[model samples]
Target: MISSDAYILGKIKEGDGNAFSLLMEKYYSVLFKYGLHITKDTDLIDDCVQDVFISLWQIRHKADSIQFIRQYLLTALKRRIIRVETQRKKTLDLHDYEFDLQFSIEDILAERQVAEDNASRLRHILDQLTSRQKEVIYLVYYLQLDHAQVAEIMHISRQSVYNLLSETIRKMKDFWENAR
Candidate 1:
């Protein structure tokens, strides 16, 4: 089955004006959710989503070279969010806002209950690691990316990716043993 994405992207590059509408129809929700997660501002998220689509339209030729369309979309969204954050920081007072990215107490309690109910197994204990370790683990496992890709994305050396993953896995093993 030809994916709607392949069809729409193909048509879009051919100068079909309506192809953009189809592309937006196929990916808008996915884009919006990613924007919401990154920016945490509904209006800013919407603006970023729109700008990404505009950029995509302007550079449709690069679409074929992209290995993972979702990854490309996410990279674009992330860049847009960063730019917005930088611009906002120049004028807005951020002192009133908390930078807590953790889940709420209610959410933690609910997750704990679910874990206990399920006799939950820690298939991968990346959550217990430091931020850098967690990023390495997530890039390697969750994103199914190679060490090279992880290193490139994280702006570190390939050897550093290997080192971080080795340490993270060892820590996970220790954490699991302690938990048991």
Candidate 2:
């Protein structure tokens, strides 16, 4: 059985380097992929992710205090990327950046043993959504995070998260119906 995050965190708090490695190993891919959705510069994302890990390691004593590890990492990465990009471009508004959510629905459907045609159709349907809607779909369904956590990560209110999700669902339904 895979070790629980709490267990890994316990070992980390005790200064177990391997446990920290385990934590990093568990989350690196997800964090990186999520990072890709936010920014086009892979190098910048990589640097930000490494910096996040470094910061987390520097505060290992507080590992146990984090109730949502994945959410915390994602939020930190998002902020880091925006900060770095803003400074690099000399932009004053962090909200000026757009989420470039490029989802590979075929890969996801293939993993679930879904047929190719269905994957193509679903991808087509999803392609109709706004970037914010797509990001909400990814955070809520793909990441399986709660609405409140998604709101916190996206820097939006919980009710806005709900509204976005509902709007996405409505649009998807309309698209699917029209496609038939």
Candidate 3:
């Protein structure tokens, strides 16, 4: 049986260093990618991820039970990135950032020629979406997170999450239909 994040967190609270290491390894890449979407600076993103983990270790005993570790780490990473950028007098609008997520169907396809054209077209359509729309899609679809989790991570209401997702899907459908 796989151990849950909540269980690992409990062990960390008990001063288990191995549990802390496991937590860091599990979330580091996901958190780093999320931070990259918020800030273009690689060093800044890396630093913020490290800071989040360090802070988590320091506050393990006082931290409340975390039902969703990915959401929790993402929220922390976003906050850390924002706080750091704010201190440097950078613009604070969430939509002001760029998203660099890459989607490739070739990785999933055994025969490259079979899906090459479709993948290219899909990539082009995805590139047409606004940064906010892409971010919402990435979190909700690629990350497989629910509306509530995405809302908390994005600092938006649940209704906003639904609205954004709806609009994104509608736009994609329209684009795809027109393309066909």
Query: Which candidate comes out best when scored by lDDT?
Result: 2
- Write down the worst ten-residue block by lDDT for model 2: 171-180
Residue 25 error for model 1, in Å? 4.4
Lowest-scoring 10 consecutive residues by lDDT in candidate 1? 94-103
TM-score per prediction, in order, is: 0.59, 0.82, 0.80
**Clash counts for all predictions:** 0, 0, 0
What stretches of model 1 exceed 4 Å from their correct place? 1-8, 17-26, 88-128, 132-165
Pairs that collide, model 3: none
Which candidate should be chosen as best, given TM-score against the real structure? 2
Better of 1 and 3 by TM-score: 3
Q: Report the CA-based lDDT of candidate 1 relative to the real structure.
A: 0.63
For model 2, state the Cα shift of residue 140 in Å: 1.0
Candidate achieving higher TM-score, 1 or 2: 2
lDDT of 1 by residue, 135-160 (tens): 56655765577776666555578998
Model 3 C-alpha lDDT versus the unseen true structure: 0.78
Question: Which candidate order results from sorting by TM-score in descending order?
Answer: 2, 3, 1
